[model samples]
Target: MKVLSMILAGFVVGYAVSDIRPFDSLLSSTAEFGSPTTIVNGLTVLALTACLVSVALARSSARGVLVVAIGAVLVVVFRTVGMVTGMFGDWAGAVGAGALLGASAVLAGRHRAAQASLAVAAIGAGLLGTALDALLQADDGPVFVWDVAGAEDAVVPERAIVMVIAALGTALSLYQAHRDVALQSHETRRTLLVGLPLPIAAGVVSWFAGGHDSGDAVWLGALAGMAVLAVVAAFALPGRDGRVLLVLFASATIGSMGFAVEDSLQLAVSVALLVVGAGIGYRWPQLYVGLGGLLVVAGASLIEGYVALPSLSQFALPFVVAYALVSVLSTAPGSLAVALPALFTMSLPVTVFAASYQAGLSLSSDNAVATRTSEPDHLVLSLAGLVVVAVVTVACAVLMRRPTQNPAAR
Candidate 1:
């Protein structure tokens, strides 16, 4: 149960943090409001501090203590710098600044060290949160094509502060809740070896395969890579965590592949993919896998539509189901919010395409029986896809609510 909670925490936090901040210049716009570099720099330092402090405070090892000290110094340095530069302000800033100093004093007493450490971590986290609002005011440049389409707009970049805090906090809390689940845990150690290579090799192979061979080779490679990751994670973590990864990656890969299939055959392939994906999600219930698959399907549908490969109406079902599945599957609020804009963007083409199809069908004369028959019977099938997602979502929620007894804790 603790492990599940921790994984949920990490997913929520990681998604939240990744949503608000721009990872690369291409991913964000920084010209209108002002430079985001300042806030980014500040948060980067704070995030590092939080991770260090969390690990340091929880572990009673020499190296852990050293990390804790370094983290403390970083918090002090960054907060002090923020104050001098007039970044941190008002009551929250004052409270955070005070806590920084008082935290040090509390740490001096062995009995209350954990409490003190928590305080410091809180201060650091609070400071980082403030930095996100400041970063939102950062200058965003001209609107690009994606911005107009409701895709990834450079106007508002999602920051990673929430994710970092959540991840660090969850890591710390989990470590405290179960000492056996710490950095030195057997699972963690084994994951270090398997998680490193499979995805990397898969990505490299997929990239080199390029625009030829109808995307088959790339799809197969992704499946193989995800399988490897699942095997390793299952052997190492051996529980819900491993199951989550397997489902998430497998669904994503299959959905993406379905989207990449020839437009004429999109309905058949997408249905097949959806079935395969939903089956995995049902059996595994991995949040990450479901979300990943949702994203891939959404992306592929957009590309397919753009190329005039698949009829626009053909995309509606996938778009609806994928987004709906994502919102329900992911525990991360940040990820959910980020996904909304993408959903809205994807909906436009699908909706436009559908309306046009219905109109064309209506305008056709009875004499044009061939045209009527050829009007692509994809709409009904697409709606069915949406129904599947809805059913899966309900089932997943119910499953998530069920109680599980954990003997490990006992």
Candidate 2:
């Protein structure tokens, strides 16, 4: 029952965080806001809200679950209202959903050892949610076209169903937490306050960067700065918070391959692989071994990007990403609120910058009338970033392997 509760919490959080097309639909409805950049920025704000709320409310499970329930209800209400009135329902519902994500993470993180299974469920569900959303909402193109005005309506019923499921899941988890879990009141740490600014700055930079028509230099600089900020924030946080934050940051950086897939079938396969990898990771949970495998797979994906490759090779990236995330989460100590939200926040800029860079490369090549088709230059950047992440992962893994002077800090 306890494990099941954690899994439920994870699934809801994962779904809420990954599913943002409804909000995109809202932005597209307005002529002035119909641009892809506008939609991305709006969605990014919604995600940042989740991260910020998660960090701010990390201390209490009771409060977190209450917020989760309220958020779930609001999602249903706002979505339904949006369908009928065509007003701000989408925005309101998205904010509610974001609250669900933030609060659910707090609840799930409260469960100590079971955090591994919860992490796996959360990540797998998140990938599955993305795939499902793409399958449901995609037009006739290989990529998701977000400019369509009524896209949110297509997923309204689905969103309501999931929000209900999330509510039920939160209730179950809350019950279990009170019944069986040894509840602890974590001290308000100065590190938590210090770490907050990094994500805010990253969010602002990503928002502005998204709106700009500048060259790749701006995007590259932003990406580099976001990476550095993530590292600094990870170290600035204390104990398990820092360790887990670093692991998640590394996992997310290398996991960019999974997010880059476009084909529907390939995406479905990737999601399945993510589930399988999560299971494997939960069973083993060796941080260094998982990081090593992740690094190797990332390198292979980078190489495959340049070479003509079979479609089957694309699935490997999601698997290693899930494996690495669960393995790290299983062993690393920290507040899930800190690590998960920080990862969510930092990823916004990384994702925007990567997409912008890829778009810039494609445009430049198009203008030059290049005949030979190949992967964008961003894969090289991802590969380079992975090498740095690998080094940090090793150091964090080593530190986590040692006994803590204060067990309570965990």
Candidate 3:
């Protein structure tokens, strides 16, 4: 399970690097430094993968062949990342590389970590990659198009702070997961490997959405219906049920992929939603809290349709949906207040800081960026939404304070 997770992280980092530096050559195609971002990220993934494979090799000889094969595969992935261009070629390359990684991980079998170090490797590298990307971002503040040049700013501190919190948060979650698995809880699966297909499909779908018209009513209806099914799957199925998770991921991925696909402004926001869903599954504690978190989202969406809330704020909807699955079936109501910070941070706070830092650094502090996200209404509605969220969270917390209010906990 842990090995697969690590491999998944490595694969994602590889993909991110490819996206970050799609072109092989720099300006005029004469620069000696060819896609510095891609080269660096590729090296990072290679180093991590090699480290993981080395550990596995130390435990057994059978892994040696697997190690060689994986090394060869990584070489191929790195070489082709820039060699390939355009939508079709990129899609094929990504899918092919991901499949190779998946096959290698599966063939290698699971490794026993002396101290749950495997999960830490997977979780840590994944977290660090995002932080590095955020920290290294240029082009004003936290605007999402992170091309590989920028002087650090105030956002750096906030990202660093979040990185610390993420590390501790993941550690706690892993510990609880270990306990659950030790107790033979059904919620703990052998691996989330079965769930990997959703992201691959999502990446492709998101890319497809990015280039085309998704404004047609048919696409909207299809996506909305998928989302409804995804919510239904959350309520009707078990926590670790593969089929249900597949539905949930597909819905969350494609639904958000399609919803924000039409608007160029929503591209970053859409990517953010997909990342949250992919990175953080419906893990413990999050299983029920999603319901309360989503209540705020649904309300906000309705209001946004009329009042024109910033599109970045709309990104929060999927995170809440992913976090706040319909729990009435498996668990009772949960405290919304508990999930408020997480929901907010993962969604709006991220958007705000991205916009804020951009506004503060690149654009005039007095004048907003030309982006729709920079509109004045973003601040006003966002804070009002947060206040409303806080009030709702408190009410739910008070109500769910009783054990009967949260059957899932029992």
Which candidate tops TM-score? 2
Q: Model 3 over residues 71-168: C-alpha lDDT tens digits?
A: 44443333343333443333433343333333233232322221112222222233234434443453444543322222322123333333334333
- 1-410: candidate 1 lDDT, tens digit per residue: 33332332323322322222222121123422123321222223223222233322332443343333334333333333232223332222222222222222112212122221232233222313333434444355222221122222232323323333444554454344444422221122223233333333333333322212223334334334434544453334322223323333333332322233332244344444443433443345445345444444445444554476654333443432332342233211111111111111111011111111223445563332211111212332233233333433343444455443221210
Query: In candidate 1, where is summed lDDT lowest over 10 consecutive residues?
Result: 344-353
Ranking of predictions according to lDDT: 2, 3, 1
Q: Where does candidate 1 stray beyond 4 Å?
A: 1-188, 205-214, 236-241, 254-410
- Model 3 superposed RMSD (Cα): 14.6
lDDT of each: 0.31, 0.55, 0.32
Q: How far is 380's C-alpha from truth in model 2 (Å)?
A: 3.3
TM-score of each: 0.31, 0.71, 0.36
lDDT of 2 by residue, 339-358 (tens): 66444555533332322222
What is the Å distance of residue 233 in model 1 from its true position?
Answer: 4.3
Task: Give each prediction's root-mean-square deviation over alpha carbons.
Answer: 17.1, 7.1, 14.6
Worst 10 residues of 3 by lDDT: 332-341
